[model samples]
Target: MTDRNRRFLLKARPNGMPKTSDFALVEEALPDLQPGQFLIRNHYASLDPAIRGWLDDAPSYMPPVALGDPVRASTVGVVAESKAEGFKAGDWVMGLNAIEEYSMAQAGGFSQLIDIGNVSSPTHFLSVMGAVGLTAYFGVTEILKPEAGQTMLVSGAAGAVGSLVGQLGKQAGCRVIGIAGGPAKCARLTDDYGFDAAIDYRGKSAEALSDEIGAAAPKGIDLVFENVGGIGLDATLLHLNRFARVALCGLISEYNSEHYGARNLWQLIVHSATVRGFLISEFLDRFAEGAAAMAKLVGEGRLRFDEHIEEGIDNALPAFLRLFEGSNQGKMILKLI
Candidate 1:
């Protein structure tokens, strides 16, 4: 094992989209583990849109990552040493391990031992069986409540969460329409993920998108599982059916911008539609139930997921930036091992 720990620390708060220079990679000697603490050799770390929100010095679901601190991220690792009860060496675990080659933590925090017996790849814990799946499951099954024969639309439909959202909508018997950036992603949405139709929002105007949405869902959308929250959302709003529901999951389109507001919000009133924003953490108490259901779907071959992996801790910052640039094809993970 290496004697030093490699980590990326936040150097500056981002103004818009995060730049690689906003972070600095540093190496430090690993410390001795204390009683009740376990040492982890992190193998993989998740890159997510929520990490962008954590960089800003503003009120949010969690505290911001302080300058000079290791940037916060969820990671999967194997326990190399442990003094904690119920956790032993060689056990695979998941936690808020940040971006580092090593992490030391107590049992009471976000760390939890995970079973990888049934999974083909442990990385699925960061994709289909992890937070991405939980978000998609709760957002659609509990919040959006899409019905059979109804029409459901998902923005960022080719993403890790959005792809699952579209599939879940289909499983619920809804006619699913996806909105993604490129022709290939849009094609994958319909051909691969089972979306009934797809809209390529690459260079289309909002008016053009609205027309496309109208053509796709002529009966109007019954549920909008939103991820991108800019022009696509505005266009989607224009085509909402009466009493429609929208699960406002994430706003990746506006994550980097200062002026981030959606037009056509008035359409909510016109259509008597309901929009509710949620954090996956809010449903933590029932995470087991949701995770179990998602696992069952994966086990039954009813759910599909994808990951875009960047090898090594050295590539962590670049991998993270891909989330904003829309270059990542699926869930982005930094493979440190």
Candidate 2:
């Protein structure tokens, strides 16, 4: 427990998109485990868009990642030492820890023991079987509630949560349409994930994108799973069916920048629609329920997802930037060991 740890700390609140200079990788001695605390040697960290929002000094669901502190992230690590009541050394666990070589936390809350018997890989705790998968599961089943013969539209459809949302929408027998950038991702939406149709939003204006959505879904969108907001959301708003339901998840496009325009917020009034903004944390008690259902589908090969893993604490900044750049191949993970 006397090992020196390398931690990625927030050096400054980012202005617009983050840069390497916004974070600092510093070495420090691991503190002795105090009473009611446990320490783990982190093996992997989930690189998610929500983590980016924490870098700003703004009020949110949680406090922002304070300057000169380890940047907060969901990490899977092994218990190297424990002074806490429920945890013991040599145990595998995952939780909202930080991006570092070693993380110290108290017992309970989000940090819980991992059943290695059910885990296929440590990274799966950060990907398909983890928060990413659970986010898609609860958002679709509980919030959006896609119905048979209905049309469901998912923005950021090529990425982790969005892709899974589209697939789950299909399981509900909804006609799923995905909005992604580029032809390759659009093709993958239909070819790989079984989306009924895909729209490429790269070169299109709001009107153009809305027209494409209308064509793909002439009946109008009954359920909208929104991830990337702004233009795509505005476009989708214009195409809502009467009394459509919209699940507002993470707005990745507005995280790094201060500029975000809806232009069509009034459409909800016009269409008698319902838009619910939710956090996955809201379903904390039902995690076991969602996990079991998603696990069954995954085990049967009915659910598919990919992880874009980048190794080393030294690569944390670049790996995170991949999410904003849309260059990441799958659910983003940082491998520290």
Candidate 3:
């Protein structure tokens, strides 16, 4: 192991999309491990849209990453040394680590050893077997509760969570329609991820997209798994069946913007539909159950996922920015090790 640890510290809060200047890379000596503490050599770090919310000094799910501190992220790594019970050197683990080369974690903190024995890659622990899958699983299975023969619509269907949401909806016997950004992603949604139909939203106006959604789900949408909020949610809201349900997930389209309004929200009243927003942390007690179910589906070849890995810690900032730009195909991961 190297004597130095490399990390990215927040230098300033971003005004819009984060720039590389907002962070500073620094190398410091690895601190001595204390009792009840373990040192992790981070291999991969997850790049998520939620990280943008954390950059601002605002009230939300968790506290903002304090200025001058390493940016917080979910990471998979190996224990390089340990002084904690239930952990040992060489054990693989995942936790709310940081965008750093090494991290010090406590025994009963967010850090937990992960069993990657049945998976082909360690990155799966950060994708299908991690919080990404857990969010999709609980959001779809528990929140939406889509029934067989119902028509379900998923926005951002080509993304990591949306991709899984679409597949889980299919497994529940729903006729799934996916709305993605471009033709390639739209094609992958139907051909690769098992969506019944896919709508490309690239060059369409709001009315045009709404018409496309209507064409795709002529029977009207029974369930809407909304990930991209702005135009997509507005479009999906126009065709909700009576007593329809909406699992409001991430609103990526409006994440970096100041104005966010949905024009068709009145449809909820007209259709007597329910729309609920959730955070994965709220289902912490049942995470194991969700993870197990997702793993089973993946192991059985019933669920699918993809990862867009950016090599090395130096590329972390660029990889993160790609999420907002819609350049990432699936889960965006920084391969540090």
Candidate 4:
């Protein structure tokens, strides 16, 4: 491949919140693929809050997107050229691809092939059919162990994982309450997503938020699927029923903070509540199972998922900022030709 590759790079580590200066866009000629390698033309990229942790230099489940390296993201695209025996050109696949117009991968790096035959769009993989679905599925069933009639509250309910988690909770016969920023997102959660209740965190104080959540779950919350931590978790901790399960999915609030206060963790011990942190990578062995179950639910019209896509790789920084601003209603993706 002699084509020029357009890409985005992590120019600098962010101190608290990322700015446009943290990234730099560049163009380079693509290198020829070796035998057993394939060239991919990336079309869609997943923009996740977890990517913020990947920008730091600290050790994590995966290393930070290295300085000057194309930002790491899950992407869907078609194989333009292939030398591997199992893969042929024109196959549609999704996996860990850099945020760029084109990516070259050795055979081992590519995961399962995606069947886009009856799916709505390729971008679905970045949301319902991809890692987001797996994260929500496992987090709800395995981690939370939610029972029918139990009450479930999800922070960041408008996000990719949280939205699905809340819907699955409702499907399981639980009363679902969503916590999201702003009235618009709160309204979307209750009206559009079938949540039993939605609370606007921007308007309510932490104490008032706890009271509202408490009123929603009069019997006390059986499960809390947490995405944004810090204050939200602190407020919710005051209302946990005995033996409640809290799935720590992502700490978007604290992810970018230098230091965050947690003043209410003692309530966990008081209530015998259990909180477990989960990384989707740990459930990778069961990804196929999770994906199949989520797909079946979606195919059967038992689930509804959404994606907010921003066109062009050049807008990646601003697009990513949407996650923190609560500007996106679902899985956020970047489109690059």
What do the candidate models score in CA lDDT, each in turn? 0.91, 0.91, 0.92, 0.87
Mind giving the per-residue lDDT tens digits that candidate 1 earns over 1-337? Answer: 6679988899999998788889999999998889999999899999999999999999998999999989999999999999998789999999886898899989898999899898887898899888999999999988998789999999999999999999999999999999998889998998889999999998888999999999999999999999998889999999999999999999998888964588899999999999999989989888889889999998898988889999988888788888877789889998989
Clashing pairs in model 2, backbone N/Cα/C closer than 3 A: none
lDDT, residue 297, candidate 3: 93
RMSD (Å) of each candidate, 1 decimal: 1.1, 1.0, 1.1, 1.3
TM-score of 3: 0.98
Residues 1-337, model 4: lDDT tens digits: 4489998988999889998888899999888878998888888999998889999999889978889999998889988899877778899889897899998876778445788996889998889878899999999989998889899999999888888999999989999999998888888898778999998888667788888888877888889999988777889999999999999888888877864666888988999989999888888788889988998999898888888989998889989999998898678999986
Off by over 4 Å in 4: none
**Displacement of the residue 203 alpha carbon in candidate 1, Å:** 1.2
Task: Assess the local accuracy of residue 14 in candidate 2 as a C-alpha lDDT between 0 and 100.
Answer: 89
**TM-score of candidate 1 on Cα atoms, chains taken together:** 0.98
Residues 268-323, candidate 2: write the lDDT tens digits: 99999999999999999998898889889989999889889999999999999999
Candidate 3 residues lying further than 4 Å off, grouped into runs, are none
